[model samples]
Target chain A: MMCENQPGALIKMDLGSLTQTAHDPIHLLPCEIQYDGHAAVDKYFTPTICQGVSAKEVSFRGRPLKGQEIKIPAGYIGLVVEENHRPCSEEEGRTVCMKSTFLSFTQWNLETLPSADDCAMMSLMWPKISEAIHRPVDSEE
Target chain B: MELEKFERNNWGSCRLSSLVPPLCRNQHCCLGIDEAGRGPVLGPMVYGICFCPLSNKQDLEELKVADSKTLSEAERERLFEKLDSLKEYLGWALQILSPNVISTSMQQRVKYNLNALSHDTAIALIQYALDSGVQLREVFVDTVGPAEKYQEKLKQRFPELEITVKPKADSLFPIVSAASICAKVARDRAVKSWKFLEDLGDVNLDYGSGYPNDPKTKEWLARNLDPVFGYPQFVRFSWSTAQTIVDSRAVPVRWDDCDGDEKSSSKGSQSMLSFFARKKDDTKHQPHRFFQERKLETVKDL
Candidate 1:
C-alpha cells in the first residue's frame, strides 16, 4: 500500500519503466524502499522524485509496473537482510543471533570523499599516529 | 728393607740440612715502599712504607695483600687496619701540593717537580721506618723516576741504607702493595675533604676527576676563560689547558712591551742582526746558506 503523502513509509516493489516529470516544483517527499531483484531499473521521472533517492529508475513516490524488476543504484542508502547482528563472530553465542553484516549506503556526496592517495597515505602513516598525538609529561625527577 | 732403600734414594735425604729453612745469614731487613695519587689531577701525592720481620712471611700472605687498585676501598681499609696492628713497624708520608704550585711548577719543569716531590715523600717514609728500629739493609721502592737516579737521590738522603728502586715493585712485592693501599686510602680521604670547598664556586672548577676527557672539566674551562677563579692552589697550573686559557686572554702588545726593550739592547741580538745582513748580501746563495756553510767547512776539514 502506498500513501500519496505520508511522513514515513516503506515501499517494496520491482521498479521498472517508471516515468514522471514536473517543473517548477517547490517541495519533495522522501521514502525508504526495498528492491526484489538485481536487474537495472531505468526511467525519466520528476526531479522531485529523483532529488533524494539515489536509484536510477525507482523514484520517491512512483511504483513499478508489471513485468519489471527493481534495481538499487550505486551509492544508495538502504537496509539489507542478514542472519546475524552481533559486532563480532566471537559473540555469536548470545541470544538474538548477535552478529550483523553491513553494506554501506551508496549515496555519498562525491565532493566530500577524500582522494584515494590521501586515504592510502593516512593508512601508511597510522603506526606512528600515537607518537605524533601523545604529548610528553612535563614533570620528571 | 725396601722402605730404607727408598728413603736413601730420596733427594730430601740427600740434603736434609737444606730441608730445614735456611737460617738468616746476612740479617737483612726489607722495606716495601709505594706512593699514590701521582696521576690524579686534583689531590695530594702520598707515600707509605710497611716493614715486617722475614720470619712473619706467613702472616703477610694470610693478610691477602695485593695492589691497592685491585682492592675496593673497604677491603683496603680492612687490610690497612690489620697490617697496622700486625706489623711491628709502619710509616706514612704525604706531600700536599696546592694547585698553584702544581700549575706553576709544571710550566718550568713539566711535572719533574711533582715527581721529585713524590720521591721525596717516599724516601721520607722509608727513613721514618728505619728510625723506628726497622733495619734498612734492603729498601724496595715503587719506581717513579730513573731507577739509578732515584737510587742516587735516596742515597744522598740516607747514605747508610741500601735502596732497590724497581718499577712495578708494588705488584711484584706484597709488602709494596700493602703500602700502596695505605697511601691510596690516605689520598682518598684528602680528596673527600676537598669536597667541602665545592660551594665556593663551580663544583667542577677543579679538573673533572683529574682525568683527561672529563666533559665537566672541559666545559668549565670553556666557560671560564680566565684561569684565576675557582682553581684551587692544589692544581698544576702549567697544564696545557691552563696555558691555552692564558694564551687566549694574552694581550700581544703587552707581552711585546715587556720584552721589546730587553731584546733590542742585548749583544746577542746585535750579532744575530749582523749575521742575517751578511747572509742576505750573498743573494745567489741557497736559502739554507748557514747550514750549507757548516756542512762544507766540516767536509773540507775532513
Candidate 2:
C-alpha cells in the first residue's frame, strides 16, 4: 500500500498508480517510516524533464534520429529517485514529482537503517511520533 | 513550492494570476507584456500580459497606464481600477514567481536563470491567449536583457505576431504600460496580503517594498535574520543582498571538495555517487510495477 500525503514533492514511486483497488485500506506499515517529507524542493530532474519535449522536432544536432532521442541526464541518485528512466513515453519518461508513497517495508523497516556515514536518517525520526507514520498512502492510492 | 515548512504562507508558494478580458471577436488585438519586482530580492517577481483590439488601444491610452516604476502606488491602483471598469477592452494575465522558487532555481548547480524563467512564463501567457481563441497581431514587451536577443527569442516562439522587445516598452507603449501596471499592482497586493502560516504573531513586523536597498525592508530583514535556518519565506536567499547577510552570520564548515574523487584508485574512501550506486544494484528483484518511471509535477494550491 502507498501513502500520498503531499503533492509536488519529488519522490520515487512505481510508474503506474500504486493502488490495487480504489478502496484499499491505507494505514502505514507498522514500522518506523524511513523517508518522510522528501518534498519537490528536495531534488530536481538532473537532465530536466524538458528533453525531447516536441515529438515533431526530434532530431540530432543536424541529422534526424530514428525514434525520439531521449537524453536522460544521469538521473538524480539521491535520497529520493529523481531520474528520468530512458526510453519511455513523453509523459512517463520524466521523473514523477510525488511524495514517496510507500515505505520500503522490507529494507528500511528492518531493526535499523545503517548509520555508518552519519546519514540524514539518523536524526529524522522524532522519538514521539516514531510510532504512527508508517501507514500506507491514503486509500493505498 | 520550495519551503515545505511554510506551506501555510504564500511566501513560499508561486502562483499564476489571470484576468481574462472580454474576448475580442475577429478584429486583431495587440498584446503587451512586462515584469515587476525583477530587481527586488525580497518578494515574488510578477510577469504580466494584456491584450485588446487594435481599436481599443485608444481607450487604454486614455486610461493613462504608464510605466509602473514612475507612477505612485496610489496612482497605479487608481489606473488599474479604471482599466477594470473598461473590462470589455482589456484582457490580462500574470505569473507570480515566489522568492522560494526564485532562490531554488538560482541556488541549484544547474541554474535556471531568471531571464529564462521569465521568457518561458511570458511565452506561456501568449500561448494561453492564442489557445483561448484570441486573435493577436503584435506583441510589445519591456525587457531587461538585450532587446534584439529577447525579441529574437520571442519571435522564434511566436513568429506570426509582430513582437517588439525593448527597454521601457512600458513607457513607449500604452498597452505595455497597462501590463506593467497590472503586474506591479498585482505584486503590491500579493506582498501586502501575503499570509504567514507559521504563527509569529507576537513579533509585529511590516515588510516595505521588497527592494533590497529599501531601508524598511533592510531593517525588517536585519531584525528577523536567523543564524542557522535562514530568513523567512519572502527573502530570496540566492540574492547577494540576502546571501551576504546570511553568510556573514553562518559559522563556515571546511571541506575538501575533491574528496574521494577517484574511488577505484583510492585505498578506502568512496565517492558519494559510487557508494549509493552500489546499494541500488543490490535491489535487483523489485517488482516490475515498482520500477516504472515516476512522474513529478510542481503544483499550486489555492
Candidate 3:
C-alpha cells in the first residue's frame, strides 16, 4: 500500500497558533471503541471531573474513569486531523484537513490513574532519545 | 415518576420524596430509615425513610408492614402500594445511590468505603425530612455497623430526636419495616428497568438478585465481562466479587498509587551501578528500569 503514489491538496502548510483560543480539551481513553465514526461526544459523554487526592475522578457512561493531565513533551505539539470523505480507490490517499492543535491531552484510565510507567507515557521519551543518539560525536572526548 | 429523572442522570445520586404529610408536620412523628440492595454487586443502593404521626402507629401496623427480608417480592410490592395509598397520614423519601456513584466514591484515592456511603445516605434522607418541616420526634434506623456507635453518631447529629439504631430493627419496629418495604420496592423497580447507556446491542436482563453469590448473577457477570473496559456501568466495580472477576478475566491494569509487590521488588533490586553503566563498548548494556517498566527501548533498526 505504501508503494502506490497518491496526491491530495494541502489546505494549509501550517495552522499557525491554533491553540491561542480556548477549546474543548482532547482526551485519550484507555478502552477501544469498535466503531470508527463521528460521535456527539460533547452532548453524550459530558465529563464532570472532580479533584481527588492524587488524581482526577470522572465518569463515562456510568462507569468510573480516572484521569491525569499529560502534558506534551517540550518542543512537541499535537495535531488533530479530520477526513470527511473516504478514498474511493486504494491508490487514492484520503484527504486530511487540520482541525485543531493542542499542547497536552488528558490520559484516562478505567478506575485508576495512569503513571509514567504506562506504555503510552513512556513512548513520549523517544524524541529526546533519538536526538541524543544521532548527535555528532566529539573527537576530543 | 422521579425514577425517570434518575435514569436520565444515572451516574449520580437522586432523591425522591413525597409531600410532607400535614399530620406529620402538625404533630410529633416517628421516622424510620432502612436501606436495600446493599449487598448486591449490581444496581443502586437505596435508602428510604417513612414517617407518620405517633398517633397513627396502629394504622401503620394495620398495613401489615413486616421485615422486608422475610417478605417475597410480591408482598413487598403490595405493602409499598398500601403504604402509598395512605399518603395523607404518612410521608416517605428515598435516596438512590447509583452504582456508578457508589463505585467511584468507594474507589476514590482516599478510599470512601461502602459503609460510610450508606451512613451518609441515611443521614441525608433524615436531614431532608427535618428540612421539609416534618416534626420528627423519634427516629429508628436499621444499623449497618455496630449499633451503639451508629446510634451515637445519629444522636450527635440530631440530639433533639429520640434515635434508635439496632440490628434487625425492621422486624422489631413497624415503622422501620415500612421503610424497608419502600426501599426494597424502589430498588426492585430500578434494577428491573435499568437502561444501559452504552450501545451494548441485544443484551439480556437476566442477572438474578444482583447478589455476589447468586449463580445467575455470577453467570451474567462472566458473560458480560469486557476484556478492555471490564463490565458495563451496571456493576458495582468496587465490590470484591466484581474486582475478583476483573482481576482474573480482564487485562491487568497498574495504578500509580498502588504499592504492588511487583513494583516494589523491581525498584528495590536496582543497583546504583546500573544507573552509570552507559559505555560505548558495552553493546549488551541494559536500559534503565523507567524504560523497562514501560517496555520502551532503543530500536536499533527501523
Name the top TM-score candidate: 3
Minimal lDDT window, size 10, model 1 chain A: A59-68
Candidate rank order under TM-score: 3, 2, 1
Give each candidate's interface RMSD in Å. 51.1, 18.7, 7.7
Instruction: Find the candidate with the highest lDDT and give its number.
Output: 3
Write the residue-wise lDDT of candidate 1 on B203-283 in tens digits: 444456654357766665555442222233334345655445544652211211235568767855576557656565466
TM-score for chain A as predicted in candidate 1: 0.17
List the lowest-lDDT window of 10 residues for candidate 3 chain A: A1-10
> Chain B alone, TM-score of each model?
0.64, 0.78, 0.88
lDDT of 2 by residue, B41-143 (tens): 7777888888899988888777767899899999998987777667666777777777766776665435678888888888988897898677899899998
Per-residue CA lDDT of model 1 for A1-141, tens digit only, reads 232344233233222211221112111112112222321111122211222123322111111111111222334322332232333543223222212222221221111222223322233333354455575856872
Better of 1 and 2 by lDDT: 2
Which has the better DockQ: candidate 1, or candidate 2? 2
Error of 3 at B152 (Å): 1.3
lDDT (Cα, tens digit) per residue for candidate 3, span A1-141:
122133332223234445453445887776555445455454334334656668876675335677888878899877776555765665444444556777888888877678986677887887788799999999996
Candidate 3 TM-score versus the reference: 0.69
TM-score of chain B of 1: 0.64
